[model samples]
Target chain A: MDAIIFLIFAAAAVIFGINVVLRTHPVSSALALIGVMASLAVIYLLLGAPFLAAVQVLVYAGAIMVLFLFVIMLLNAGSEKKSRGAWMARLAGVPLLVALLTILSFVIFRMYPRSVGVKFGSFAAGTVERVGSALFTTYLLPFEITSLLVLIAILGAVVLGYKELD
Target chain B: MPANFVPPSGVEYIRVLPEIILAAVATLIMVLEPLTPAPRKRALGYLALAGFAGALAGAAAAGWRTGPAFSGMLEVDGFATFFRLLVILAGLLVTLVSFPYLRREEAESGEYYALLLYSVAGQTIMVSAADLIVLFIGLEISSIASYVLAGYMRREKLANEAAAKYFLLGSFATAFLLYGIALIYGATGTTRLNGIAQVLSDPRMAPAGILTGTAVALMLVGFAFKISAAPFQVWAPDVYQGAPSPVAAFLAAGPKAAAFAVLLRVFMTAFAPLTGRWLAIMWSLSLLTMIVGNFAALLQTNIKRLLAYSSIAHAGYVLVAVTAHSEEGVQAAMFYLTVYVFMNIGAFAVVAYFSRKGERYVEIEDLAGLGVRQPVLAALFAVILLSLIGVPPTAGFLGKFYIFQAAVKADLLWLTVLGLLNSAVAAYYYLRLIVIMYMKEPGDSLLELPGMAVSTRAALWTSAAAVVVLGLFPALIR
Candidate 1:
C-alpha cells in the first residue's frame, strides 16, 4: 500500500516538475511548480516527516506559489521567446543531459538497493511536538533572526514599490 | 533528547542585546517617520546615528563575554566582537555620508535609516551565528535591506536596474548556499557548526567524502559571489555603477566584510579537518581573482566601475589570507577589512560629494581641475586614492603588507608574489584618477562647484583621519 502511494505521488511530482520547465508562459509554469511542491509534500508525509510535509504545502505550495503568481501578474510576463542560439548547443545539450541523468540514476541504485525499503513508520521522529521543541530550544536563534529577515523583505517591497513623497 | 538542550530564557535575549537595540530603534524610526513633518526628517538621521552609537557601545560591553548563546545557535566570541565593531563602524560612516545625499535627492525617509540599521543588525547576526541556518537568515536580512537601499532612488532607472539585477543574481547565489547547507545537513544530520565539526572529525560517524566536498564547493561559490570574487564578480561593476554612491560604498565595505567574516568562521570551524582539501581551491581562487580583478580594473574609465573592480581585487587579497588558513591569516584578514572600511568609504564619499545632484559627475574626467576649484576636497580625494593604491603611510599599504606577510608565513610565497604583482597593476588605474584630478586642466563644461555640506565634510575628514591613524597605529585593531 505504501509503495503504491509513493509511486503515485512520485509520478505526479515528476510530471509536474517537467511541466514547470516545459511550459512557456510564466503563469502556467508557476501553477506547475505548485503542483510539484504539493506532490513533494505527499512524499514527505510518506517519509514520516509530517511537520516538513505540512510546511512544504503551507509555505512552498501556498505562500510561495502566490508570490510567484503575483510577480507574473505584476510583471505582465508573456510567453518566453525562442532564442537564436547555436544549433551545436542544442545538439550537445540533450545528449549531455541524458548521460548525466543516467549516471545519477546508476549511482543512486548502487548506493541504495531495493531490499532496503523506506517503510512509512520505520523512522518516525518528525512529530510537530518534537519539531517545535527543537526549534524553540536548539534553533531559537535562527527562529528569532527570521523575523528580522521578514521585516527587511517588507521594508524592501515598500521602499521599492512606493511613490516618492513630496 | 540530547543533554544540552537548554530552554529559551531571558538571558538569551540579553546575549542579543545589540541586535535588539538596533531593531527597536529601526522600528522606532519607521514609526516616527510617518508622524513627523518633512522638514523634520533630518532628526531621523540623527536618531539612527544615536542608535548605532548605542549599539556600538552595547557590542563593546558585551565583547567581554566569550561563549555560545541561545543554545549554540549564536556566539559572542572575540571574532564576532571584531566583526560586530567593524560592521557598526561601517554603518556609522555610511549614515554620516548619507545625510546630505538623502536630503538633496528629496528621498529622505524613515525607511532609509531604518533599513541601514536593520542591515547592520543583520550583519551583526551573521558574524555571531553559530548555526548555518542562523547565518543564512542573517544573510537574507542583510541582502534584502541592501537591495532596497540600492534602489532607494526609485525614480532613477539605473537604481531600479541595479536592484533588479542584484536581487536576481543574489537569490540564485543564496539558493546555491541553501542547497549546500542541505547537503551538509544530510551528511551530518545537524546544521550546528560544532556538530558538523564533530561529524567530520570522526570518520566512524561521518566520513570526509564526496558529499562534504560538494557541499564545501557550493558554499564557496555562494561566498565568492557575495564577496564579488573573480569569475563570479560580473555583478559588482554594474551594481556599483548603477546604485547610489553611499549605498554602493556600504555594499562594497559592510556586506562584503560580513560575508568574509562568516566565510572564515564557517570554513575554519566546521571544515577545519577538510582544510588540506579546500586550501588548494582557495589558493587557486585567490590567484585567479587577483589576476582577473586587477587586469579588468585597468580598462575602466568610469570612477565607480574602477572602484568596483578595485573592490574585487581587494577581495582577492583577503582571499589570500583565507588561503593561508592560519590564526595570523584570520587576524590579517580582519585587520585588512578594518582599514578597507575607512579608505573605500572615504573614496566613495568624495565620489558622492562631487557627483552632486542627480549623480551627473561620475566619470573619471569629471574630477579634472577639482584641485584648482576646491583644494581641500581634492586633497582629501587624493589621500583616499593614494590609500587605495597601497602607497606608503596609508591604511591600504599596511593592510596589504600584513596580508602578504601572513601568506608568506603560511608558505604561500608564490601567491604573495602574484598578489604583489597584481597590486602593481592595480596602482596604474588608481593613480590615473588622482592624476586626472590634479594634473589635467579643467574643461569649460565643468559644473559649478557647490559648497560642501558640514556633515559630508565631517564624514570625509573623519575617514581620512581614520586611514592615517589606523595606518600608523596598527595595534588599534589588535
Candidate 2:
C-alpha cells in the first residue's frame, strides 16, 4: 500500500517539477513549484517521515510559496520572452544530463543492491519523537544557534529595506 | 514525554559565553538605535566596541574551561580559542576603522555595528563547531550579515552590485557545501567531526571511496569560493571593489579566517583518512591560486582590487600549509593568519582614509607623494606594504618563513620554491605603492585629503605596532 502511494506521489512530483522549470511566467513556475512541494510531502509521508512531510507542506508549500508569490507580484513580472537557446546548451545539455543520471543511478544501485529493499517501519530515524530527542540533546547547540541565524536574517532585512540611516 | 530534554550544564553555557555576550549586545544595540538620537550614533559604535571587548574577555574566560560542550557539538580547545580570539580582534579593529568612514560617508547608523557584532558572533560559533550542521548555520549567519554590510550604503550602485553578487555566489557555494555534508552523512551516518573521522579511519567501517571523494571535492569547491581561492575566486575582486572599504576589510579578515578555521578542522580531522586522495589536489590548488592571484594583481590599477588579489594569493600560501598536513603546517597557517589579519586591516584602513568621500582616490597613483604630505601616515602604510612583501624582521616575513619551513619539512619542496617565487612576484605591486608614496611628486589627490581621525590613527598604529612587535618577538605566537 505504501509502495503504491509512493509511486503515485513521486510521479506527480516529477511532473510538477518539470512544469516549474518549463513555465514561462514566474507566477506559473511558482505555482508549479508548490505542486511539486505538496507531492513531495505526500511521498515523504509514504516513506514514514510524518514530521518531514509536515514541514515540507507548511514551510515550502505554504510560507515560502507566499513569499515567492509576493516577489512576483511586487515585480509585476510578465511572461519571459523565450530567447533562441544557447546553441551549446541546446546541443549538449540533454545528452550530458542523461549521462549524469545514468552514472548516479548506477553508483547507487551498485552500493545498495536490489536484494536489500526498503521496509517502511525499518527506517526508524525520521519520527518526530526521535528528532525531538536528538534536537534537545546532542544537537542542542546547533538548534539554539539556528535562532541567532534567524535573528540575523531579520536584522539584514531591516537594514536593507529601510532608507534613512542618519 | 517522548522527547527527553537533557538540561545543559553550566560548563556548556560558559563554553559559549563569548557568542552569548556578542548576540546579547548586538540585540541591545538594535534596540537602542532609534532611541539614541542621530548625532549620538557614534555612541552606538562605542557600544559595539564594548561588546567586542566583553566578548574578547568572554573568549578568554571560555578558554579557561576548555572541553567539548553541548554534547560535543562545540569543542573549546586551543585551536578554537586561537581562531575565536583572531576573529574577535578582527571585529574590534574593523569597528574602530569604520567610525571615520561612516562619519565621512554621512551614513553612521547603529545597524552597522550591530551587524558587525552578529557577524563576529557567528564566526565564534564557526570556529568552535564540532558538528557540520552548526558550521553551516554559523556560516550563514556571518555571510548574511556581511552581504547586508557590503551594501550598507544603499545609495551606492557599486555597493548594491557587491551585495547581490556576493549573496548569489555565496548561496550557490553554500548549497554545494550542504550537498557535500549530506553525502558525508550518508556515507558515515554522522555529522560530528570526530565520529566521521572514527568511521573513515577504520577501513572496514568506511563507506565507498567514490562517495567520500566526491563529498570532499564538492566541499573543497565551497571552501575555495568562501576563501576566494583561485578557480573559484572570480568574485573576490569585483565584490571587494564594490563594497565599502571598511566592510571589504572585515570580510577579508574575519569571515575568511573563520572559514579557514573550519576548512582546517574538517579536513585535518574528519577527512584525515582520505589525505592521500586530497593532498595532490591541495598541491595543485595552492600553485594555481598563487599564480592566478599574483598574475591578475599585476594588471590592476585600483588599489582595492590589487589588495583583493593579494588576499587571494595569501589564501594560496595558507593552502600550501594545509597541503603539508602536519602539526607545524597548522602552526604556520595559524601564525600566517594572525599577521595576515593585522597587516591586511592596516592596509585597508589607509585606503579608507585616502579614498575621501565616495572613494574618489582609490587608484594606485593616488598615493603619489603621500610621504611628502602626510609622512607619518605614509610611513605607517609603507611599513605595512613591506610586511606584505614578506621583507624580513616583519611578522609577514616570519609568517611566510614558518609556512615555507613547514612545507619543506613535509617534502613540499616544489610548492615552497614556487611560493617563494610568487612572493617575489608579489613584492613588485606592494613596492610600487611605496615607491609612489615617496618617490613621485604630490598630485591633486592629496589636496583635499583630510587629517586622520583619532580612531583611524589608533587602528593604524595598533596594526603597525602588532606587525612590528610580532616580528620582533616571534615566540609570542610561535
Candidate 3:
C-alpha cells in the first residue's frame, strides 16, 4: 500500500514538472509548479519529515507562489504568444525540457540505492514538536533572521511604493 | 566543530558600532531632509560626510580585531577591517563628488547622500558577514540602494533604462545565489562558512552529490555577475554609461570591492578544497575579460563608457590575483582595489565636471585642446589616465606590479605575461584620451572648466594628490 502511494506521488511530481515547462501559458506553468510543490510535500511526509511537509506548503505554496502570482498579475502579463519574441520562445522550451529530463534521470538513478534507507511508512521522528524544538533552539538565530528579512522586505516595499508628498 | 554554540550576550552588540552609527546617521539625514528646505539641503550632504568619517574612524579603531559576533553571523578580523576602510573611503569620495553633480542636475541631493551612506553601511556589514544569510541580506541592502541611486535622475530616460536593466539582472542573479545557498544548507544542514567547511571535509558527510557541485557553480556565477566578470558582465557598460557619472563611479569602485572581498573569503577559506575546479573557471573568465574589456574600450567615444570598459579590464586583473589563491594574492588584490578606488573616482569626477549644466555631453571631440584651455585640470586628468593605463610613477602601476608579482610568486607566469600584454593593449585607449585633450585642435572655440561646487573641486584635487602620493610610496600600504 505504501509503495503504491509513493508511486502515485512520484508520477504526479514528474508530470507536474513537465507541465511547468511545457504549458505555453505562464499562468499554467506557475500552477503546474504549485502542483509539483504539493507532490514534493507529500513525498516529504512519506520520508518521515511531516514538519517539512507543512512548512513546504506554508512557505512555498502559500506565500512565495502567491507573491509570484501577484507579480505576474501586477505586471499584467499577456498571452504566451506575446510573452517573448518568436526566437526566444523557440529557444526557451528546449532548455526547460532538457533540464527537467536531466534532473529526473539523475534523481531516479541516485534514489535507487537510498530507497532502502528511506522508509515509506509514516513516522513521528520529524513531527511538529521536533520542528518547534529545532526552530527555537538549534536554528533560532536563522529563524529570527528569516523573520527579520521578511520584515525588511515589507518595509522596503512600503518605502519604495509610497509617493512623495508635494 | 564547537557544537552547542549559544548567542553572545549584549556586549557583542558593540562589535557592529560603526555599522550601527552609519545606519543611524543615514536615517537622521533622511528624516531631516524634507523638514529643512532646499539650499539648506547642503547640510544633509555635510552631515552624511561627517557621519561616514566618524564611522571610518570607528572601523579603524576596531582594526585587526578577530571575533565572531552575533553567533558567528558577522566576524570582525584583519580582513574585514581592511575592506571596511576601503568601502568607507569609497563612500566618502562618492558622497563628496555627488553633491556638486546633484546641485547642477536639478535633483534633490539630500536623499541621494542618505541612500549612499545607507549603502555603505550595508557594504560594511557585507565584508564582515560570516554566514550565508547575513551576506545575502547585506548584498540586498547595498544593491537595492544602488538601483535607486542609478535611477535617481528619474526624468532621464537613460538613467531609468540603466536602473531597470540592473534591477532585472540583479534580481535574477540574487535568486540564483539564494537557491545555491539553500542547496548548500540542504546538503550540510548548516549555512555557517566554518560549519559548511567541516561538513565538506568529512568524507562521509557529503555523499558525492552532483547537486552540490552544481550549486557551487551557480553561486560562483551569481558572484561573477556581481563583480561583472566575463559572460556575466553584459550589464556593466550599459549601466555605467546610463547612470549618473558619480553613481557610476560608486558602482565601479565600492560595491565591486565589497563583492570581491566576500567572494575571496568564501572561496578561499570555506571552499579551498574546490579551488581545483574554480581556479580553472576563473582563469578562463580572467583571460576572456582581459581580451574583451580592453578591445571594446578602444572603440568607445564617450569618456564614461571608456572608463566602464577600463573597469571591466581592471576586474580581470583582480581576478588574476584571486586565481593565485594565497595570502599574498588576497592582500595584493585588496591593496590594488584601494588604489583603483582613488584613480577611478578621480577620473569620473573629471567627466562629471564636464557634464555640469547637462547642456554638453563630454564626447572625445569636446576634450580636444582641453590641455590648452584648462591646463591644470587637463594635467590632473592626464595623471589619472596614465595611472589607469598602468604607466610608471602612478598608483595604478604599483597596484598592477603588486598583483603581477603575486601572480609570478604563485607560479602563474603565463597569467602575469598575459596581464602585461592586456595592460599594453589597454594603454592605447587611455593615451587616446590624453591625445584628444592635448594634441587635437579644439572643436569648440573656448572650453571652459565646468563649474563645480567647492567640495567637489576639493575632492578631485584631493584624490589626485592621494594617487600621486600613494604611487610614490606603495610601501606605506604594505
Best by TM-score: 2
Q: Score the docking of each candidate (DockQ).
A: 0.59, 0.68, 0.21
Q: What lDDT tens digits, residue by residue, belong to model 2 across residues B358-448?
A: 9999999989999999989999999999999999889999999999999999999999999999999999999999999999999999897
State which docking tier applies to candidate 2: medium
**Each model's lDDT:** 0.88, 0.92, 0.81
Q: Model 1: residues >4 Å from true position, as ranges?
A: A63-67, A70-76, A85-117, B1-11, B444-446
- Predicted candidate 1 versus true structure: per-residue lDDT over B279-389, tens digit per residue: 999999989988888999899888899889989999999999999999999999999998888888998998888888899888898888888888889888888888888
The stretch of ten residues in a row with the least summed lDDT in candidate 3 chain B is B1-10
Interface RMSD of each: 3.1, 2.0, 5.6
Ranking by DockQ: 2, 1, 3
Chain A TM-score for each of the predictions: 0.82, 0.83, 0.68
lDDT of 3 at B365: 71
Best by DockQ: 2
lDDT of 2: 0.92
Candidate 1 chain B, poorest ten consecutive residues by summed lDDT? B1-10
Candidate with the larger lDDT of 1 and 2:
2
Error of 3 at B339 (Å): 1.0
